[model samples]
Target: MGNQLHASAIRWLSHVPFPTTLVWLPETVGADEEALLLAAPFLGESPDGLSLCRDPLGKPYPARRGYPVPWLHISNTHDGGQRLLLAAKHENLVGVGLDVVHLPRLRSPHKDRAYLHRLAARFMEPTEYERFQCAARQDDEEALRRRVAAHFSLMEAASKALGTGLKVGAFMGHSASLPLSALGALQLEPSVQLFFDDHAQTRLATLNAQRWEAYWGSDDTYLVSAVFLFDNEQINKLPLDEQTPFMSY
Candidate 1:
């Protein structure tokens, strides 16, 4: 994993407007080690010199010399088995969100297509769900499962960016009564829109007036998703032309 990024990941990360990094590893890395070890490069600290502290909402940020670095943000998720995903970005007004879904579990006998359809219904708009169901009916079970899982991953990732978990308010809906679909219309950065990679399933949107960049990708084992939120200040702080390529992990 020495600085090499998956081709799909490279294409997906290239569209981000700021220096963001993602790390995927075995869950055995140790819970605390997830951030401390992987975050050292971005935080300018050796793993031994870094620690973690959480905000009131329980979001973790790295601490250096025993002082918390509030401006930098980190997030992590475990696959419920043997994998972990972490994301980090060092901007004063930014946050990162991540989620991992085990695809094989979704196909378990008890968690079949109908079960997934029911889960999707809880979050998707009625019309969106109808369309998904219609398409799923004609598609193979695995395709349907992956598409539904992608939508879930994107929403969960957005919630993490918002620091609200999966609450109703994170829906980004027109109203509390109606929420937008995960694949619904969104205001994306022009560069992101032009270079969109279907393989990575990237998406960008605005939530509570903050800029949210959401992305997802998968292998046979699991689907990983991440989001980066640039608060209003960070959003306006940099001009598009001045933004640089993503940082190395």
Candidate 2:
């Protein structure tokens, strides 16, 4: 609706270390379908990139481009269904991957453990599970959220970078052990580091995966995740302004 509302959303994602902003289009002001259409523009194409195809099921297939580096796409909707979509890019080949989830949609507490287990089992080792179980027993919601978000966000970012969807199922095959502190720690593939930050009621994580860094942000209301790609020289040349949080979206 107004700049104030947009500013609030950007503040929610202040943990990201990039110059990020959200754009609201007239058509997407209150429609989910229109919001999805806006995603096409960020892909460097028109809204109707792909023709709707039928596998005999009348299913619609929209043509989408694979992100070559780290980048993030995020959408925020209000009670009336109005939405705002954001596309953020990093200067390096290392880009960002982002995801947002409405907290109310998460399963009930009794079922949350099971859900977390199933998702974690797909990517975590036995010891990691044990630690997560302990955290759950202690009712450590923050710790649990960080663990889950870190695991899945990294998986998604890796998938985007490789131009392969979750079809590879690497997330289900690999294992990760994440710590419970705000600075959650995970021993990932060589040269990779994972950092967790909680702010404004959100949990944000950063993964230095290969030559890129992937970040995940979530809160009681939504989850925002992203991936950033960068090379050694570019990383060193990153403008200082990119790190300064802006007051506008």
Candidate 3:
């Protein structure tokens, strides 16, 4: 149903020992029935007992599963023909959030001028700008550009996971300063592990964050990043791709 890396990623994620199912969906046309598709993978033979419910704000919660899943939270996002679905069991984890964009969507006339500088100033910390400055000085201008895109994408996805979306919650630039190397790594691999900067974890109290990265599928023209809360307080438990779940699938 998916590429080897994607299928492997889901299996790796599902083994987080948190009683969650990470399902991958194929790109489809028009509006997709996201809620239905979230449970479609695990429905197996007995699809009758699985139920999907919504809260006051129309947030989805998986009430029961025909299999053993008791409580589930799903975050669905579709952009530029790419679809990402994230689910976490409510009892083991608080919630899940996701954000993704077509990298080309960032294409704008305001490449790097007063307007772009103004927006960057509003969102990024002064220290963050220093990192960007260092990158810009390099001969690899493409890496510098991709770093900006990857870092901003991480900010957006992290905010969504905090249940704040963009307007009020998209201000990570003020408090968070991710490693430039990590940001660069994301442009090539989606499995990189990223821990929050010192300010974010202790000073800002903004989000309990870790391990958000980018992906470029064989047929995909877009980049992707996702963020999620952990079951326990071990935020930096292990390198994301190497963290073996304490519980079995």
- What would the TM-scores of all predictions be? 0.67, 0.49, 0.56
Best-to-worst TM-score order = 1, 3, 2
Model 1: residues >4 Å from true position, as ranges? Answer: 3-11, 42-48, 83-85, 90-92, 125-128, 134-138, 167-209, 233-249
Q: Model 2: residues >4 Å from true position, as ranges?
A: 1-18, 23-86, 89-91, 123-146, 168-210, 233-249
- What is the C-alpha lDDT profile of model 3 across 1-249, one tens digit per residue? 334443422343533544334444556752134434434454231335656565443445555543334545566676665566665543434446555556565456666444444554555556666554554565253344455555565565555454444443455322233332222222223354333444334412433333332232221244445556654454333334543212111
Candidate 2 lDDT over 1-249, as tens digits, reads 234443432444455455444444433333434544544444443655422221122212233442222243332323223244444444443333334444444446664666766766655545555555654565455556555755555545434332222333334322232222222215332323544334201212232333555555444554444444444443434354454332212
**Measured by TM-score, how close is model 3 to the native structure?**
0.56
lDDT (0 to 1) per candidate: 0.56, 0.41, 0.45
Per-residue error for 146 in candidate 2, Å, reads 5.6
List, residue by residue over 1-249, the lDDT tens digit for candidate 1: 444443353345545565555555556646545635664664354677667776565666677777876556677776645444354544544667777787777878777777888888876756656666765677577877877877677666655565545435654422212123433212122221111122112322223324546666666657766777664645534343443323223
- Of the two candidates 2 and 3, the one with more favorable lDDT, higher being better, is 3
Candidate 3 residues lying further than 4 Å off, grouped into runs, are 3-40, 43-54, 64-69, 108-119, 135-139, 168-220, 234-249
* lDDT winner between candidates 1 and 3: 1
Q: Candidate 3: worst 10 consecutive residues by lDDT?
A: 179-188
Give RMSD to native, each candidate.
7.8, 10.2, 8.1
